[model samples]
Target: MSADILTFRPAPLSQADAARRRAMLLHPSNFVPASAPDRDATEKAEEQAGRFDALYKEFLDRGLSANGARTEVARAAAREIWDGFAVQLRQHRAAGQQMDANVLAVALASIQCLNSVLPRRPEDPHHAVRAVSTARRRLQYNGGLLHRLHPHRNPAFQDAVATLQSLEVFLTRPQQHAA
Candidate 1:
């Protein structure tokens, strides 16, 4: 008696089909990743964003239309490109770090909108500035707990403070260009 073995195999897609799949995976409009204040992470995310833009532009040049597949693909690309930032944001939120959480949340949300479609703009610094401003107001009302506390005393606190500071600097930079 011989035993029969079963193997699973999936169907292969054509080049066009595969391209579509990749586009779908990369498109993102609402969900955006947060890149915190680390230079490396921020730079890496920025690089990926540029790549995403190039890919989307090529897709549009292909057959993708703004009102059709292109829009979806762009959204996917945006979400996937910045996916790393989400993890950092979630961690900060889990740690109950208000300033970090708010800053990242604002940045991510703003960038998503800015890059969602044609005439897509770079992540607006205004969103980040607004976030920090709101957080500062909260801190003032709450007796400036973060300012009073020493970051060096706690590693996590130190990281959170550093991130907030860096994010503020990043946000404030665009205004210089405008002038």
Candidate 2:
């Protein structure tokens, strides 16, 4: 025998309820009004606007949406940060701070790429995989570059790459446990 499931029915909304809904939707608290200073700041904002011009060109070249270009901009910013970290690794070596420099570079690159993604679409499995791939590539290329710069083909370079491999395994675990 199948049991019948009864669900509760909500009463029809009255005119007052409709009005309240409209009021809530249009509430001032839901929107911040721009002040005169805000307007002035935008009008006279120092030239960051010019930066987006090439971004538009990049989008046109790639036949991508503005949003896609914006995402690429975030990824590029991470790469730039990793480049700066590469310089720091050299400084650390000169100072006799002797942990594997490439390892440090891998960690920094992984962190940068992970942090770089904006408006993350974690619900999309493909996007999550893509993020992991980007991180892995950054770590791999940085390690390769560091190895090329080494004077004597030391084992430390191999160890550094191994460290990055461990990180990649840690990073690419099945997404179900990721959350």
Measured by TM-score, the strongest candidate is 2
Clashing pairs in 2: none
The sequence of per-residue lDDT tens digits that candidate 2 reaches over residues 64-127 is 5544554444444445445656776887688876655555655575546556453375234345
Query: lDDT for every model?
Result: 0.43, 0.48
Total clashes in model 2, counting residue pairs 3 or more apart in sequence or in different chains: 0
- Per-residue lDDT of candidate 1, residues 1-179 (tens digit): 22322334446689999988766754443223334347775564344333334454565577655333333343454354236346767988999987776555544553443243323422433543454444433322222233233222223333333343334443344332311
Q: How many residue pairs clash per model? A: 9, 0
For each candidate, give its TM-score against the true structure: 0.28, 0.31
- lDDT, model 1: 0.43
- Least well predicted 10-residue stretch by lDDT in candidate 2: 170-179
